[model samples]
Target chain A: MTEQQTGDVPSARPYYQPPSLTGRPQPANLADILERVLDKGIIIAGDIRVNLLDIELLTIKLRLLVVSVDKAEEMGIDWWKHDPMLTVRERGLDEENRELRERLAQLEGTPDDEEGGQDEGDGSARGRQSAGSRSRGDA
Target chain B: MSDMPPAPTSADGPEPSVPVSDTATNSATNPATDTVTDSSTGQGSEQGTGRYLYAVCRRLPPGALQGVHGLSGEPLELVEHGDLVAVVSTVPLASFGEDALRRNLEDLSWLESVVRGHDDVVQAVAAHGPVAPMRLATICFDDDAVRARLRQWAVDLGYVLDRVTGSAEWSVKLLELAPQAEALEEAEAPASGAEYLRRRKAAVEQRAASSASAADVADDIHATLACRAKASRQLPPQDPRLSGLSGTMVLNAAYLVPDVDAAEFTAALDELRGRYPSLLIDARGPWPPYSFAMLGQP
Candidate 1:
């Protein structure tokens, strides 16, 4: 076994070496790491049985924590909007009116629906419409 | 899934006879012992030190993890069963126990550190050989229990290692760029209520068209790259808030590419970048094959 000194940092703490020295990319964002370690991997059950349901709920909480309030609002993640643990703030009149109008548009099956229907001819448009509406609902 | 190996025994090992009483005696005598001991009761039967399994790999060079530490700076140890080696460290039952983990996993900072620690070890092991990473916080009561798992799952583990050998996972995300200032200006200041509705409808149509084309571009990009990869998986797009990136993430994908094809794969990515200048193609990796290490999923 050829032992290579992968740690290049001059610090006395060998384990704290910069990740670059090992040729590994810098530590990815918390979301990326959590997604992989929590959601992916070889799940061989061990003696300690952690509740997977709790972990799933925790993942959702982390997702909410990481998302910016404005972006979460844009995505229509309203679970926390009224949660007692999270701040409950009134929506601005303009924002409320916009949501009402968008809901009305969907109900009316207006021009937006027509454009969406026409775009779905190729089968990719419906996904795009939902994704767009989720993020760019005001538009 | 039916053909997959039976899920490894949880809590109940093949040898329930492995003498938990002996472990309790050892923990009492050795203050630093990793045996699970119930803190509240100061007894070993209820709890003792659990071996936190980070990953399993084949032929890890002796001392490859010399200076590396496991979660909570615990010194790592290797438990070998045949050619498979489990990289593990002792975690106290106080925190790593099932109840403790349930609470700790909810704390973002705790989860973040553990996740990073897990990745760091996986990366260190991957530097030597292919590693099959364990999900967060997989623990065995003792080395015997760990070996029981290793013995039972050896075939599947070997299969996973074989599949991931000489390959790495790469993350590729495609984001749609924000609309130009001119486009935003056009939607503002409608001359009349009729014009306002018209502008709103037009804006919605424009967004729909742009998003549709962006989705097409994303698909094309994934297809072009997937051709160069050994295996590919499209994960859900991450939230912009978590990624600290602007614009809509249209595609989030992981590709397992052999080391030999890495250069060509990157070249293809560069070419795609030039072809779709409007989309932000965020590519990162050569990471441990986290996405491809599944035993039966392949």
Candidate 2:
């Protein structure tokens, strides 16, 4: 029975400090709880079928797939990451387009002479695609 | 499917579907339907109301929760099945229904409130005994359905409870951004356009190399921390926008550590923090055994 286990164990005031770079640490925020419950908890789910006559909806699967990227992969759920509909897929395409433009510029004998250069384009993006896409376009 | 533990035998018969007292139905509806209230918590009314389960625990004394409220300020109630007690509350069917969830799940603020409500009760339970949190928004058609689920998952639930009884979770994140760009003013202006292009490409390549090495360093640190805990899991690094942090997030790891061993774990973290002073390392925890409370783990 250590000091860490006692006190309000479930209080928002966490025993461990929130990391500095995470901005203002609100202890356990929505992400923390979500990450925990999504990965842990026992899900006891069933459709609530109302025995009514007036037009009402049928069964629905309400299981939320909200998980961090790594957690999703661990559970074999990476569809959205690869889904052609979402931003992750679109971002990949955008990166491909940018690199092709850069290469085309290079072939046209123009080496980013435009003001602010290619660095400006990179600075505007806070996207994850930039990191992984570098592998393909690298000469 | 492969990860699922051996399925427990369900309730011996169709003895589920507890007939919650729907006083309104006694005077109005068909007797056959009266026996089965579906999932609507209102019992007799067609209005879709059901109990939203937040978490489950064992050996929790009655009235342990007197003031806890769940989503939309509903009184939190406990449905006891054998030794297991599920923490739940009534929620409007129109709001929590499948169609509503499709719209509401995207609303972060709504999700946050519901999660907070869920945590308030779950945490109350965890403080006293082993608790296995349910996924966000698990609604049961009725108390009987909840009981059926309890019977269906009794074995796995017990396993989770026993493992997390004396442990807590910790999150460790590592961020190492590319090193500051080297001041190239010292180099004389390049004599040729090709020379300038070559230099720029080299700089980009150098930055990439450092980022690659930073990732390797983060991996090394995660391995070091994992060795100090009862169990460890690697979660995907959070997006910068979501986390409000700068730099590449190299590691997002969670560890299940016993209360007594927590000091040692922190000590190891501090040692690594000292070793990699330039890296941004965030460690948080003493959380309920979230990452570890899963089925099929020894």
Where is model 1 more than 4 Å wrong at Cα?
Answer: A1-25, A61-102, A105-139, B1-34, B37-47, B180-205
lDDT, candidate 2, A1-139, per-residue tens: 3356465554332222344543122467444665565444554555543222111110101111222232233323344443322333233323433443343334234344432223332332334324223223122
Best by lDDT, which number?
1
Fnat per model, in the order shown = 0.54, 0.33
**Model 1 score (lDDT):** 0.66
Q: What is the DockQ of each candidate?
A: 0.24, 0.16
Q: Return the TM-score for each candidate structure.
A: 0.70, 0.65
Stretches of candidate 2 exceeding 4 Å from the true structure? A1-26, A38-40, A48-139, B1-46, B179-204, B296-298
- CAPRI level of candidate 1: acceptable
Candidate 2 per-residue lDDT, tens place, B1-298, comes to: 0111011123442332221223212221122433234333343343556667887788666556655656776556556677777776667766777666666665666766777777777877788878888766787655556667778788888888888878877888887654453444236788775565445545545555676688789779988988888788887555543454455566778988887888898888888988998888877877777677665566
Per-residue lDDT over B1-298 for candidate 1, one digit per residue giving the tens place of the 0 to 100 score: 0111011233443322111122222221232432233333312332456778899988666567767777877666666788888887777767878778888888878888889999998888899988999999898776667788899999999999999899999988887754642265444487754456445544545655676677799889999999999999987656555566556567889999999999998889889989987677778888899888887764
Clashing residue pairs in candidate 2 are: A41-B133, A70-B236, B39-B141, B41-B49
